[model samples]
Target: MADIRVLIVEDDPFIAMDIESAVADELGDKAELIVVGSVAEALRATASRLSCAFLDIDVIGGKTFDLAAALLQAGTPFAFVSGSSPSDVPKALRQARFLRKPFSTREIATFLLGAISPLKPRRSRNH
Candidate 1:
């Protein structure tokens, strides 16, 4: 596969590390992982090219919908990785893809794989 440039936005250190580990284990050096802990930074960083993004709903002081909107406008697909329920997500993002928290590496790996893969039927990855 070509280089998979992935962005991960999460405030929790442990959770961020888990995502990083999973991506690293799955893609090794083929993955370029960008991990940020806040929504503001994630938004600014989204201006660059990204293969995909893993965003948390609740970040430090802001929600991720703004960045989600930007990614959507730019055609960069992303997945919401949060413990929050789908109802808690903004209406505009209610239909966006998601990967629930307390997730296993396999789950993360699977989501990442699908996110960067060829187009398929659009649906949330609730697992």
Candidate 2:
């Protein structure tokens, strides 16, 4: 299988580490995880190909709405992992999945699994 590039945008170190660990455990060697603490860093990370992303609503630079929009435009799948209410996410981006704060590792794993599954066919096509 092709490497699954995963982007994680979160400001809290503990939460970021937790998500990273969960992703690592879930994807094992097939995933390339990039964890960033700010919207700027997250935006910069988007210069390359990403199979999927997990974003926190509030980051160092700002809310992730712009970054989310960019990812959507790029046809990359992403989900919001934030304590904020789902209503806080604009209606346009509401289609993306939302995982509330204090989420479990199981939740992260499930999201990753779902996100990467749809990309497998695309990866096969590319090869």
Candidate 3:
């Protein structure tokens, strides 16, 4: 859990900062937040570990569904954060979590926290 990395794909500076703070408050040292404002940056960040992700539908590349596709292929859990109820998300991501704009810090935390797996299984030592 201490090595977890959470990605946030948001274009708004203020919103990104708020989400960053919320994630820190929720996961503390258990996870680190990696924020990107565009699909290119998000794609680059994917090269590293991705425990989970929160993607804003309308980013610098127009939207984040393409980035979402990459995440799905990599088996990384993710959710959508949008100011509008976008009708353009891919069918596969329809079941993904959606947090509307103006959402509370608690809601943000809850969405990301829910995606995290429980603690890793302990290794057994044989004598």
Candidate 4:
């Protein structure tokens, strides 16, 4: 399989570390994890190709709605991992997968597996 680049947009250090550890546990050396704390940082990281992303709803800069929309438009697989109610998300994006805060490792692993599954076609990063 090709290398997997995963983006994690989380402001809290501990949560970022937790998500990073989970990504490491799942993909080991096969995955390159980019952990960022703000929407600005995340937007910058979008310059590179990404396999998938885990986004926190509320971050250092603001709500992740814009970031989520961009990822959606890019056809990148992603999940919203946030304490905020799912209803808080924009209506158009509510169909996307969502993982509530205090999630289990298994949940993360499952999402990662699905996101990088061979059956799922990867979108080009040209846009």
Candidate 5:
């Protein structure tokens, strides 16, 4: 439970890093955070072991819903960290927790930790 790995997908590098920094600050050394600027990178990262992911709904060259779908299909647990309004989120993933922009590190850490909690059950569901 201590080593919570999270991937953040955002088009803006600065914002992505900010979220990563926040996770580190809140979780200290226990947080393993990875930040990517596009859905492609996020998809690639998911091939490895991940506790959770904070995904943006819209990217410059990619769609967030597609990424969410891939995660969902793979049974990977995730949350949304977006500037978009709730109504803008895809119908399939509307149930996930959303973290608005300018969120604190503590908030990101808490979200990641909580999202990862369901992964254990996800493993069972897949099997």
Candidate 6:
């Protein structure tokens, strides 16, 4: 719903910023963006009714798939973003939206808007 928020799980500082900018550019003050680099940080941030998530398939210091599973178990919707190929995502996250690296801001923004919108699909085209 409208109360839902976004949580971004990315290990790379640069990538995280990119994701943040994309979301901010589109949503502006419409939603909140929480960025965490590791699994533990993600857990703490995920302790709410998250609208959706933009998660990296591989984190520098933790298992990205674990984070995804935890989010799913918590009943939160999520999308997987990665610099690598689709094969990089764990089996569980394979069903979620897969965003390749070097994605456009418009693509990520659209995905966030669509994901948060109840009537929209959870996935979108690769950018």
What would the TM-score be for candidate 1 when compared with the true structure?
0.86
Best by lDDT: 2
Ranking by lDDT: 2, 4, 1, 3, 6, 5
Better of 3 and 4 by TM-score: 4
Model 5, global lDDT: 0.76
Weakest ten-residue segment in model 1 by summed lDDT:
118-127
Candidate 2 lDDT at 85 equals: 98
Q: Tens digit of lDDT per residue, candidate 3, span 29-60?
A: 77878889998899899999788998999889
lDDT of 1 by residue, 2-104 (tens): 3678999999999999999998997788778999999878977777788889999999869999899888888887889999987888788766788888888
TM-score of each: 0.86, 0.90, 0.86, 0.90, 0.77, 0.81
Those runs of model 2 whose alpha carbons end farther than 4 Å from true positions after fitting are: 120-127
Per-residue lDDT over 1-127 for candidate 2, one digit per residue giving the tens place of the 0 to 100 score: 3368999999999999999999999777777889999988998999999999999999998999999999999989899999999999999999999999989999898988888897664555555
Q: How well is each residue in 1-127 modelled by candidate 6, as lDDT tens digits? A: 3455789999889989999998888777767788888887887887767888998876756667887888778767787888778877767667877888888887787788777778344566775
- Model 3's number of clashes is 0
Give the distance in Å from residue 47's predicted Cα in candidate 3 to where it truly belongs. 1.0
Model 5 misplacement above 4 A: 1-3, 117-127
Instruction: Go through the candidates in order and give each one's C-alpha lDDT.
Output: 0.85, 0.91, 0.84, 0.90, 0.76, 0.79
Per-residue lDDT of 94 in model 1: 67
Q: Candidate 2, overall lDDT?
A: 0.91
- Candidate 1 residue spans exceeding 4 A from truth: 119-127
Those runs of model 6 whose alpha carbons end farther than 4 Å from true positions after fitting are: 119-127
